[model samples]
Structure formats: C-alpha cells, structure tokens
Target: MVVTVFEAYAGLARRVLARPAWLGRTRLVAVDGPSGAGKTVFAARLADALARLGSGRPPVVNTDDLLDGWDDQLTFWPRLEESVLTPLRAGRAGAYHRYSWVRRRFLPRPVPVPAAPVLILEGVSVARAAVGPELSLAVFVTAPAALRLTRAVARDGPSILPELRRWHDGERAHFAADDTEARADLLVDGAPTLPHDPDRYYQRIARHPRPA
Candidate 1:
C-alpha cells in the first residue's frame, strides 16, 4: 500500500533502533545524497520517526549550515567533524557556527547538537569514508539525474544552475572515490511512488541493521 514519507520513515526507524550500537551512546545516521535529492525533508521525517520510536527527537545537523558557499562542498567537513561529530561521539553536546548565505559569513550564534540516542547528519558527502566508521547507519538517497537537476534549479533559481553543475561534478568524484553507494547500509529511491509496499524499506533495514 502507498505510504506517506513519514510512514516510510517510521518503518525504517523501527529497524534502526532494533540493532546494536555502532556509534556508542549516540546512533549517528548519515543521510547523504546529491543537492536536490530530498535529504533535508527525509531527515526531518526520520527525526520524527525516531521520536515516535521513543528515542526522543533526534537532533539533525545539516551540512548546509557548515558550508561557506559552492566551493566549500566537501571542504567544510573538517569543521563538522570538529564541532559536531567529535563532541557527539564523546557523548556531549556539539556546537558549531552557522553559515549565512546572505552575509557570506558564519553567524556568531552557535548551533547545538544534542547528544541524543539518534542524530542525523544530512547533506552530500556525509557518508564519505572519513566518517563512515563513526556512523551507525548510512543511507544514500538518490533520484534520476535529470529530475534532480530540475528540482535543484527550481528550488535555487535558474541562475544557480552553473554552480549546481559544478557541485555535481565534485560530488560525483567524491562518491566514486568513497564508493559511497556500495558502502551504504541502505539506498533510498527518493522518488514519489504510487501504491507500493513501503514495508520493503523496513525489510531492507531489517537485513542491514548496520552499515558494513
């Protein structure tokens, strides 16, 4: 039967919580994909699902907040590692400066990453090998290239297409080098479906409780 995105995530979350700990006290979930592959929306739903599963609302850290601009794609990772991942790994609240696109600067306000049972890091390259071992479950979400491009342009305006294209090339090379998809614990088809068994997603999680 057709299920809402939230319903799909509920099934996925149930299985994630049923597994063994891979990231110590905090379950680190990496939702990595291309720019327009719906990572943000999916992460939000998954956080809600985790809360419904009695894990309390999982704090989500968007890599977008860590990026300076188009050139900073994977380069902003180290900052994320230091401010967010490191603290959370040590079972403490993580703090980071949030970047402002308009001001072209990182705001002084610190974004907090609560040490919860589950934490979602959503953005491109989030599942890269650099942080793989620290992740409990790594999910790779994707859609048709043409569809993703279209969605990106529509969301960011046509003027941003050139930047988007350049970013895509970098993402492609990074994923290739990291073999992200091959290493993923789960691959999500980030496309709207008609009537289909959403439980299949649950089954995938059941089979691969932890990313290899």
Candidate 2:
C-alpha cells in the first residue's frame, strides 16, 4: 500500500509508542547512516511527527555534538553512554556537554535530556550492535557515494573534502563490521527522485536480499 510521508512517520511513531521502553523509561530510536545521508534532517522530521502523534517533542542527541573532534569518530560512544544512556537507563535525566567544532572542545554548559517517552539518537554508528538491544527502532538512511560526498562538501565546505573522504572510508568500514544496514528496521533514500514534499515526506528504500 502507498503511504504518504506524514502517514509513514506517524505510523512509525505509533509503533514506537506501542513498544516497551528498552532504555530505562524511554524508547530509543537510532537514526544511523554514513555522513551526508541526511540523517539529521530525517531525525528532526521524525521527532516532529512523533510530537504530533502525542509523544511530545523528543530530545535528539546528535553524536556529532558529542564527538571530541573529527578524529574521535566512532570512539565518542563511551561519552554518550556515560553521560546520557547510563543515566536514562536508570530512569533519570541525562546531560552532556556539546562539543564545539570551531573550538575543538566541549562547551561549558551541559544540555539536559529529560526522561522523555521517546528519544532520537542521530548519528553514524549509534545503531551499532552494542546499542541494538536498547533500540526501539533502527533507521538507516543512504544515498549514492558520489552524491553523499557532494552533499557533504556542499554543506561542510570544499576545505573539508580531504578529511571527509577519510571519514567516509571509516564509516564504510564501521558499517560493514556492524552490519548496520542489514539490521535496520527502516531504510530511507536520502536523495529521492520521486516527487514529494521534502518537509513531510521521505522515500523509503527496500533492503537488499541477503544470501542464504
């Protein structure tokens, strides 16, 4: 059946609300994908849809904001666990200092993450095997490698091209080792060719069949 973008997201919100809280008292949703796959945009829209569905505005903890720097990459998970996940797992509020890309350090004030009914974790490897058990929903967004690189350069600037290329390589290795895409409950096309409202609709991608 054809589902509108709004309907798709609202349906997902319903499914999430129906699930038991796996992260203390919160249902965690992980939006994982390679860089420039539009995970941030998708997560934001999903959060809005969830709010409209009566889940309230969920707090989105971006892994990028938790990273110490560009090199920190996948290693930033520990900080997130210690500062955020652990607290929430205990049915309490969590807080973390946001990292400043310009300063290359964490900011002074800590951002509070209340014990909301739902939480959106958006980043490259937030859906890795280690966090799989706690995830109520795992979404993988993707686009062609060339297109992704182009988008990254466009958003982050041509000056970041060199590091971005290395970053992409790291992401490919991480995704392969974690088998993230294969484990995702939903696969979204970051760059869809179909006509739809960008703010309210996203094109869903079917997962590739795995070999027996």
Judging by TM-score against the true structure, name the best candidate.
2
Question: lDDT for every model?
Answer: 0.80, 0.89
Q: Model 1, range 1-212, lDDT digits (tens) per residue?
A: 22233236677788777765556588889999887877787788788778887759888989989998879999998899789877876778889999998899999999888887888889999998977878889998877899999998888799987888899999999988899988998877677555555433321222333446
TM-score for predicted model 1 compared with the true structure: 0.86
Q: Estimate each model's TM-score.
A: 0.86, 0.93
For model 2, residues 101-125, the per-residue Cα lDDT tens digits are 9988899999999989999999999
Superposed by TM-score, candidate 2 places the C-alpha of residue 57 at a distance from the truth, in angstroms, of 0.4
Error of 2 at 13 (Å): 1.5
Among all candidates shown, the one with the greatest lDDT: 2
